[model samples]
Target: MLLQVRELKVGYASGADVLRGVDLSVGASSVTGLIGANGAGKSTLLKTICGFLRRRGGAIAFDAADIGKLQPSQLAAHGIAYLMEGHSVFPGLTVEENLILGTWAFRKERARAKQAVERAFELSSVLRAKRKVKAGLLSGGQQRILEMERLTLNDPRLVILDEPSLGLSPKLVHEVFERIAQMKADGAGVLVVDQSARHVCAASDHLYVLRLGEICIEGPAASFSDRIDELVRNFI
Candidate 1:
């Protein structure tokens, strides 16, 4: 496994526990889908794993090392890239500028950075055409593409996403999953939490259904595909 969470638990101050004894894993080069209803603690689990929130109990292991104590920055340094909900782009920076920032760690390696930028542009021709335009001016789908390109630039070992296709059109939603599928194809482990069970199952190899902070069901994505609607009404 590339990323693993065992018997995880989390809660906010003076509030009911948001996650309860959750366990999930994402294998190298595979996509794992986590689906749940609103307030089901899907995002909370991601936050806990990335160290944005403290775990009340259990463990988090990434690439076989215990990383439960690592902060978000340290987690990123360890090859875990998290794309939170909403458009995570700088309104002021141009598309190319944002892409360059993604390669900042390799800034000294001009050749490598330039290659990464080129490859990113190749991933989205729209982005390439609008490379000099402000990211905020791009359409929502295009901005999502830019973020996708930025994350893949570092070749992170694991990519975690929350609500990746929330407000996009069906076509754009498909595009988001296609890019995520591409990330898996490129050898990155992916753990995604999304609103649509059908779409998630389509892109996932393994699936975990969260209900009220606990994993209620889990299996191969194909196992859940047929009952997607039922699952959404019941599990989600």
Candidate 2:
């Protein structure tokens, strides 16, 4: 497994537990989907795994190393890229510059940086056309794509996405999932959280249905799709 999370528990300063005993894992060759309601702690789990939130208990191991206490910067240096909700980009910077920022740790690797940027451009023509434009000027969907492109430039071993498809048209959402699928195909593990159950199921190799901060059900993506409504009704 590229990432392993076991019996994870976390909460804010108020001491109200948002996540309770969550167990999840992602592999280099797979797309792992986590689906749930608004307050089900799906995002919290991702945040904790990436070091945005401190875990109250349990362990997080990445690439066979215990990394529960690492900071976000350390996690990024260890080959984990986190795409927070809203697909945040450097609003003032040009798309190209934003992508360059993604490779800050690899600033000395000139050749590899160029190759990564080119690969990001290959994901969508909109990016190639507006490479010099300020990221804030792009449409919502376009900004999301740019954010994703920026992460790709980092060449992360594990990519964690939180609501990548939020607030986009159906077609644009499809494009977002398509790009996520391409990530798994490229041999990077993907841990995705999306409000859209159908899209998540479609993109996932393994599916975990989270409810009240716990995994209520889990199985292959195809199995969940076969009986999604029934499972969603019972668990989510």
Clashing residue pairs, backbone N/CA/C < 3 A, model 2 = none
Least well predicted 10-residue stretch by lDDT in candidate 2: 227-236
Residue-level lDDT tens digits of model 2 in 136-204: 899998998888888877778899999999999999998889889888888899999998888899889
Global lDDT of each candidate: 0.89, 0.88
Per-residue lDDT of 211 in model 1: 91
Write candidate 1's Cα lDDT for 102-127 as tens digits: 88766788999899999888868899
Model 2: how far is 231 from its true place, Å? 2.6
State each model's C-alpha RMSD to the native: 1.2, 1.4
- lDDT score for candidate 1 against the true structure: 0.89
For residue 175, what is the lDDT in candidate 1? 87
* TM of each candidate vs. truth: 0.96, 0.95
- After superposition, the stretches of candidate 1 with alpha carbons farther than 4 Å from their true spots are none
The best candidate in terms of lDDT: 1
TM-score of 1: 0.96
TM-score of 2: 0.95
